[model samples]
Target: MKIATYNVNGVNGRLPVLLRWLDESAPDVVCLQELKAPQDKFPEEAIRNAGYNAIWHGQKSWNGVAILARGTDTEIKEVRRELPGDETDEHSRYLEAVVNGVLIGCLYLPNGNPAPGPKFDYKLSWFERLITHAAKLYTLDIPVVLTGDYNVMPTEQDVYKPERWLDDALFRPETRAAFQKLVAQGWTDALRKLYPDETIYTFWDYFRNAYGRNAGLRIDHFLLNPKLVGRLTTAGVDRHVRGWEKTSDHAPVWIQLKEK
Candidate 1:
């Protein structure tokens, strides 16, 4: 089975580009973030016409997530729309489902920009909650994948210029530690496992021709549980997708697993 994740930026505005990628890649399952559309505004019919069934949680004009299972034959059994442990938090950033016999958790983790502020604090607190919840999922002992734009560059190698990002929320020491601790809970970062030394990036800022200069960061990820890691045949970022006209700043990051 091929599982992929992408931060679509805006599902409606980029529907054509997204549909094009779906037709070309044909991943068995996909985790999508940043729909930037309301629940009623989601282009469900368009996505359906492309031969995929989807479960989505939409918020107005910002933060949204979804999981898509390719083809009509697969039943997208939704597990939840919100991450546990945050009753007051209402961002539509997480969506979990069972697709093609695998448990997939799709998320758009907080970007936490403008460090040393309330947003940054919220980001850290959110990370802790995710860690706690992820621990519970790890104990399930099933084939599971947590895939999305985590928005954190977990290491120096994950960014194009480590020094420039030191003070940024996504590259702060604490942020990286939280991400590393999550991985320590038996979830393998699949892409890094496959290309340990390569400088792989899934996102590029639109400013200053960053994509053109290859200035990017590996913020998007596929974190697989031990059960799924054993089946990880290959993993990669569809970097060329970023170069497409009207594409999301994020390209698709994916992994192919052997069927159980």
Candidate 2:
């Protein structure tokens, strides 16, 4: 089965582009982030017509997420709509579901810009909460694939120019450390494992002709559990999609697994 994740940026505005990709890529399962639309606005009709079943958590004008299974009969066991540990938190950044016996944790981790500020603090606090919850998932013993736009560049190799982004939130040492700790809990980063020495990237900014210059970052990820790791046969980023007209700043990252 081929599983993928895409940060669509804005689902409504980019529905056509998304539909085009869905038809072309034909992934078995997909996790989407940054819908930036309200609950009533998720383009369900278009997706269903394209032969996928979807469950989404939507928020107005900002964060939103969803999971899509490529066939009508695919079983989708709803897991959780929001990440726990914060009662007042209402961003639609996390969503989980069980598809074809695999637990899919789709997350858009906090960006946390402007270092030493409230947003940065919130990002760290959120990371700790994710750690606690992710630990519990490790005990489930079932196959789990945590996939999405993580918003952090795990290493200097993940970005185009290490020095240029040294102090930025995404490449900052503290942010990367949090991601490392998550991996330390036993999740396998599929793309990194598959392309260790390569400068793989999943996102390219529009400014400074980033995409044309091949300036990008690998923030989107697919972290698999030990069980799923055994089935990881292929991993890649659809970088060309980023160059499409009116495309998201991010690209789709995917993995193909051996049958369960």
Q: What C-alpha lDDT do the candidate models reach, one value each? A: 0.91, 0.91
Estimate TM-scores for all models.
0.98, 0.98
Clashing pairs in 2: none
Which candidate leads in lDDT?
Answer: 2
Show where candidate 2 strays beyond 4 Å. none
lDDT of 1 by residue, 106-185 (tens): 98899888897999998888889889989998888678889898989989999998898989999998899999999999
- The per-residue C-alpha lDDT of model 2 at residue 194 equals 89
